[model samples]
Target chain A: MNALTTEKLTKAYSTKVALHDCTLAIPQGSVVALVGPNGAGKTTLLEIATGLVKATSGGATVLDGLEPGSLAALQRVAFVAQDAPLYQAISVGSLVHLAEALNPIFDRDFAIARLKEVEVPWKRRVGKLSGGQQAQVALTLAMARRPELLVLDEPTSGLDPLARQEFLAHLMNQVATSGMSVIFSSHSLAELERVADYLVLIVSGEIQIASPLEEIVAHHRVVVCAPGDLDGRHEIEVIDRQLDVRFGSHLVRTRNMETLRGLDSHATTLEEIVLGYLRRAQGIRVLEEIGRS
Target chain B: MDIDKDSLPTQQDHPSPISFGLDLRSGVPTYLQLVQQVEAALRLGHLQVGDRLPKVKDVVSSIAINPNTVLKAYRELEIRGITSGRPGVGTFIVVAPPTISTKAFDQLRSELVTGWLRDARGVGLEDDAIVALFHSALSESMYLANSEGSRSESDGDA
Candidate 1:
């Protein structure tokens, strides 16, 4: 079943359109990374999905069929905003109790057990815990509700590599154990490459690409060919071609892979491929063209 | 993930566990590497039939490899009778192929190497010379990436 769907979803921030008539189906129990450059409307899209921000046009649906922000929907899709709002004065137990108090579906024992797994102090207040620990507590509370959809916004922005891994690990473990679908946004291609199943690559408030991660990595390669070897090549589309005294190749992204090896070089990386798509969407495809669709 | 830094191990931070180069980088891709690794592990007896592999989520978090990639590998292996996946119970190694082993990877690699051999012979490159050339190119690529990394580190981000 499509756990969430946006039908021509559009959102505007001031005169600038933050999202322009985007449409997609997100299957149940899958993880989607809403990827884009900064200000690409990823945050705007997530906000609209959770009904924190209303869409200027179009509509969204959650679960089999439901209003985007209705209480039933809200109860179904729990959110952990990038700036997780936790009461500093409330102890970990108290904060969980808050969720228990607020959510009829709250699973208290599971929440406490989750905290125990992470070594979170039961008696300590949110203010006393480290940034990571607090984030973990907030996460426990979010998961405690056992919502069908969990959306995390720029979840690991300032986290060090190890902490980021742990956070993601815990998140995915919950996903596996609970069969919950997750959609989070991030600007980091490498991280997303390693974690996400599906992706929506947004650029300047438009959905540039949305597909399974495998399809992406399957296509697109960076081919390095000598200047003369390019031969004004019409076979494969090149994204970034530059001449160098040593490497003699340009970074490129393309769906056509056969011509890549024939171009006299190797393929690029997961990160470069993502960057190439973003670059193409911004520079080549006009925003108006995206909006019209 | 918003977590304290000290609570976790620095990435690959181990003095180095017994790991194959299941790289998080490269579009050559994680699942292919995973397939290769598991196959190698089986041949070396590092894993055996009926042994439960790590939970899909555990692999995703600990190694930080893409879950889709892991799923792809697992699915393909199961199809090939190299492994079996039982929903909710995790994946397990299949000691014996329910049928014949295709040895497709071996055949394909051999065929490609043969083509490379013919090309080198046509181009007057010998076996040792070809081997050296392959190593040199691999090393060059590695060097370029590392050099590029250090240069970026020094230029301004420092």
Candidate 2:
């Protein structure tokens, strides 16, 4: 069963459509990257999946057929929000004790071990620790529960480069050891490229590409076509097109290799693929405005 | 002198049959990195026919990657006839990599390599610089070839 599946999930706040007709399936035991810019509905989608927010239409399921937001489902899923939420007034030891008291399956030893592994002071107050330390503490607490699925929202946004690496290393170690399934959203493509096996590219509340990272890289290419030749292509989805006014050259997504025939095409990186989708989204917005006028 | 039995070498103490690694900064896809590592080991004679590969679980846990990535890399090796899996057991190196033949061609290739090294040295290129330069050049040329191949194939289709 999928770790999480959303079917045409839609969420709107008044007139602002946060997410629209979004359908995605995150497989079990895969580290999936939910990628987008800051305001591209990544937070809304994650919130709905965790049941922190309600979907105006459609639904999301967690871990084989459990209804999202249900107590049973919530028990099996752990969420580490952007700002790792913990009681700042309590000591690190108190937080662990509180977690143990609250979670039936909490592994106290494991939590303590994780903290020690990261060298987080057990005697220190949560309020006094650095942002990285607080994030680590929150992660350690969530991991102690031994949840079936872990969802993180821009987990390392506040961390320095070295801290981010260490954090990801710890998370990767856990995933390797426990076969844990994870879904994390991040704007940092390089980090995502390193850790994520699956890619979910979301732009303007829509999922443009969702597949294994290797498959996405294999199927997508950038073709530098002779000017005026790109207009007649209907064999593949054109994510975006750029015209080099100085050289009269056209750059377009090959979508598949079929349209790349007789054209100069090159393999693209994850960043380039994402930028193409974002550019295309911008183009569509511009067209809509033009039509309205 | 006192000798510790634990320090003694045994059959199991020999170097592992297969050692897999990846460079996250290498820009090569993870699965391809795995495949390339195995192929390099085979070509360098570090691995032999019938050598057992590390279990999928071992690779995943040690490297902290998704299990499917290891599986995909293994599948690619299998497809190339370099390795085979035994279901309940584990994957094994089934054959040595194909070797280059023809002494004349080898001599010519070695001469070309020597000339390139000489030219690189003349330009005051260090070992790392030489490797980087070669890799960049190869990738750039391969991209040109790749696009050319695609263009021809599409033309044929049309």
Instruction: Indicate which candidate wins on TM-score.
Output: 2
Clashing pairs in 2: A261-B154, A262-B151
TM-score of chain B of each: 0.51, 0.62
Tell me how candidate 1 scores on lDDT: 0.74
Instruction: Put down candidate 2 lDDT per residue, B32-88, tens digits, no spaces.
Output: 899999989988888988787876666754565666778888999999999998875
- Residue range with the least summed lDDT across 10 consecutive positions in model 1 chain A: A255-264
CA lDDT, candidate 2, residue B63: 64
List model 1 lDDT by residue over B46-130, tens digit each: 7777666665666765676555666788887888788887764557777644433579777878886788777888999888998
Q: Kindly list the per-residue Cα lDDT of model 1 for residues A1-293, writing each as its tens digit.
A: 87779889888778798989899888987789888877788888888888889999998887767777898998998888885668999788888888899997998998899889889999998889877787787788889888999888888875777777788878877776688888999878788877788888888777767887766654455555565665555555666555356455566544434344344455456677777776666655566677888
Those runs of model 2 whose alpha carbons end farther than 4 Å from true positions after fitting are: A244-256, A286-293, B1-27, B41-67, B74-96, B102-158
RMSD of each: 10.9, 7.1
